[model samples]
Target chain A: MEEREISKAVIKRLPRYYRYLGELMENGVERISSGELSSRMSVTASQIRQDLNNFGGFGQQGYGYNVKYLYEEIGKILGLDKKHNMIIIGGGNLGQALANYVDFEKRGFYIKGIFDVNPVLKGLSVRGIPIHMLDDLESFIRDEQIQIAALTLPKSKAEEMTALLVKYGIKAIWNFAHIDLDVPSDVLVENVHLSESLMQLSYNITRYEKEHPRS
Target chain B: MEEREISKAVIKRLPRYYRYLGELMENGVERISSGELSSRMSVTASQIRQDLNNFGGFGQQGYGYNVKYLYEEIGKILGLDKKHNMIIIGGGNLGQALANYVDFEKRGFYIKGIFDVNPVLKGLSVRGIPIHMLDDLESFIRDEQIQIAALTLPKSKAEEMTALLVKYGIKAIWNFAHIDLDVPSDVLVENVHLSESLMQLSYNITRYEKEHPRS
Candidate 1:
């Protein structure tokens, strides 16, 4: 499919489809109809069919979809079938948490190293990925052919580190920094703003209170 | 405005607007036209006007918006102006990371306690918030009037813990567990699927490669 044909909404929902199908596969479900999958996913059957059709329909009209087959196909489309080397650029609490995250490898992201300027964290390791000095980041990225850099740095350091990573030829960034980074249009960034999400929860709670006032 | 009137899409974007306006305020940007704000935000001026209009338009005909006033208005709409006491359940890596996170307090969610099933983790303190035994979760929530529960537990524990939290009167859950929680309609949950996002970055990288092939 051409890039223009695929909408941002569709691309965003691709991961949700990938996740739900993964669960079904793990549960040993062999097949599922669009309607059944839709019920499980909280999306409409037609919408589900439409999304899958964008990448060539994996579902059969009568036989439904082979769960494993569909999962693999979606995984392939998501580039999850091959390993992508990654590095965490900060060794702070959040960065250390991510370094210890076990699911990234299972989803085909191999964290090659963790980097920090702090002297105390230099020799430490989390889940076998040793913390390397920030000085080595450029050489490491080039040497390992690292494709993604996970920035867990402070807001003050985010822009500089992002530019450094882009300069060293990293193509994508999973940013956990509080601030946004300005990058060329070619570089992909997925900003995970924890505060924004917490605020959403705050809004929901407030809305609920206003709707269902205490009697 | 009534709960029925506002769309979820608008609710989701409130934090983004809040964040952007905040940056402008910090930079000493006193006032901004929708067109200028739109340029900085990468959103159209009409869309910005529409979003702000939901809560009664804050901008004037020619003067545009006062950055501080707009920021404060958005904060009020998002319920970020009031303090919401919270607890972090499951004192694991992710939970600990969040417990140490300073931004939540700055944003109005004050984490009062951390709970864990592990005996070793119990009685430990992170950022001065003690990790209490999981058994005390019920009483702690009641005593603290905790409005939010940040769940960073393993998937196996999510459902049971969610039920417990709801029973103890948790209004919202910020779930980091890989699995979806079964909650009542009134109980709000915002699932943060880390791997799904990583997959998105992977897909983007692949798309970039397809678009700009190495010669």
Candidate 2:
């Protein structure tokens, strides 16, 4: 339980850290201290220690950390060691773009199929992944052993498809739709409310200005 | 200065609270307490109080909080006042869907234009917003006063567009392109790494199971 809360914050930052670590590992850096990591990442050293403490004190007081070991540990914490088979719902620009996306695949998720209600899009191949009609969603998820679902559908259709995913036994959903969904208390849904994010960024500009105070 | 760090956390959670409050507002909820808000939100009450304390203590001793006032205050804090002009880059399914979205306008965000390098997509109306060529991005952003930009471009192009936006004096970009962007330190580039979010959900399921000891 002590580890879980810290992991939440750590998990959010892991992707950014991974990109940096990947560069370091690629460059053959073999060790890093919390101080070194903090300096490189522009965060406080204590923050690095606290975040790492949640996953057991993996760093020694003076010995620093093995870059390879820490990178692997972060990968394990982020569940990047395991490949996640995913399905995209919508088969539109977002869906097609995801199907062809090299980034997710590099990051440990693979899109196996795209689903849409439109028959015209069905049987179409986007970046090598087949587009199936809505009815095939259940079978594709089950047969492909798809573990995650990406909801890029419209708000009107999002809830309906979410229910279908839950009914079909999908464990998690990355919802791109702009609606709040009421799932069973256990289902994990991250609603990517794009507008709200924009609002936050706009507010951040104000927040940053307030903090820095121009000199 | 006393509230800076606390405010960042509170500010992020404000949108979540707003969504929850939006539901209650529709349900005609007139008043709520910190305890009630905590229970409904699955968060700690002390955390709620501390967050609220980032600003002046607005919650009365026993009378709780007036829902309407809180909602309006959060909206203002989040910079959700009036409409925010936005441009959708890439004109793919996700971009078109964003342009086609009616909810953004309802949420005080206006989709001003859609841009694509494709000639076929140009000169067309995406959800009534004119789809322009990528070449016109600078003129369009300046003329329309667009501060918010959503990138649905392929990963390779995401970073390029982000720098372009910074060049055009755009302060914030909601990146949907799934790439880590290098922008000027001053620009607020919010990269919603979809893959990382999905990984978090997957990892959370494992953590949730362990904590609950599900049979």
Candidate 3:
């Protein structure tokens, strides 16, 4: 088993594992070893072994990870064990979608609030969550105990707002702003550049089609 | 140099390399070999070499890679060199924010249109791109040669919409759905699961704080 100081890369891999495991559970898959997971996810068995080791060695020599147990542990380590209070910083469509995101609650996270700098959205309610002003971040974070703040502000505003959120003691940020966030070393900043992901997909699909012709 | 049939995984690393290279460039680093870049990005040196090999060998035996050229070549390989007609499907907050995304233009892609099923957003414009109807997708892609799409639809609708887009001859998709997608093996689907990204960030930051503490 590995320590709790998980590698950032390994942590990122958790989502894929979560999704994969969720499907495996959906299909009534009872147990899975690291090798089975590695084959399905296209990651190495040893890599999965190492990643699993961080939380606690769950895999046995002959038997692999218990699919349910591994899934539960991964969820716990990723903070899905307890309901996470989430707030979106921007009240735009991204914020609305995030507010309406069903997987959060299904995985034990809650949308505490969604806020924007725009004065008009202050009183508006989207998906039953009252939109609030940016000024309310500190109070809301403290009162709601928002463990994750989705930063969906504009390009020019990302850095500024991220700093503001950090001041309010937001632990982690899911930044959709296409800007390079300059956050404190202590705060976790995850930038989701949607376009870059698409570009990669396009390039790969083009190449895949060429190789397979008709898959 | 590697063949055009590079693993999607290797191609995905290009943008990160480009981003890191930009940082190194800004810091006035002239040239960097694979070993140096691998260290900075916390990846293996062979990985750096293999990834770069996908876009032609960018390194020299003695000197190293020409930073600017390497970045440019990567941009080209990722289709960042050509002007891409981009559309944001499901004109929600994420779509609106993406329409206003500042980096796309700078990076050589353009948001030509945004469409939503919501009639309220119909004919409305975000950052100058007129929001259209969902029915307009096929026509627009044909007429405008839309090479890419950013789909931020609801999880329930995500797979269906993505399949539709790929069927409509969309070369690539940037999916922001919080669900796993099933795509044709040849079709490219790059998912940016916001929840997953946040989970990784949270656990990794937990690790970073525990290890470095002060840096």
lDDT of each: 0.89, 0.78, 0.77
Q: Across residues A105-209, which tens digit of lDDT does each residue of candidate 1 receive?
A: 988999999999999998889989999998898899999999899998888899999999999998899999987789999889998989988988888778788
Over B76-126, each residue of candidate 2 has an lDDT whose tens digit, in order, gives 767677567888887777687677668678778888898889898868987
| Residue B135 lDDT, candidate 1, scale 0-100 | 82
Q: What's the iRMSD of model 3?
A: 2.5
Docking class of 1: medium
Report how far residue A150 has shifted in candidate 3, in Å.
2.5
Candidate achieving higher lDDT, 1 or 2: 1
Q: Candidate 2, residues A78-140: lDDT per residue as tens digits?
A: 777778898988887667766776777876788898888888886788888888998787788
Give the distance in Å from residue A58's predicted Cα in candidate 3 to where it truly belongs: 4.4
- Taking every candidate in turn, the Cα RMSD to the unseen true structure, in Å, is 1.6, 4.0, 5.2
Q: For model 3, how does the per-residue alpha-carbon lDDT over B1-215 read when each residue is reduced to its tens digit?
A: 35545675777777888777777877888898888887788799887887777677878888888888887777767666667677888777668767876677877678899888899887889888999998888999999988778887887788788888888988677777777666666556677777777677656555555567664
Who wins the lDDT comparison?
Answer: 1
| Clash count, one per candidate | 0, 2, 7
| lDDT, model 1, position A194 | 91
lDDT of 3 by residue, A44-78 (tens): 99988887776777788988878888788787676
TM-score of each: 0.96, 0.82, 0.74
Better of 1 and 2 by DockQ: 1
Winner by TM-score: 1
For DockQ, the strongest prediction is 1
Give per-residue lDDT, candidate 1, residue A149. 94
> What range of 10 consecutive residues in model 1 chain B has the weakest lDDT sum?
B1-10
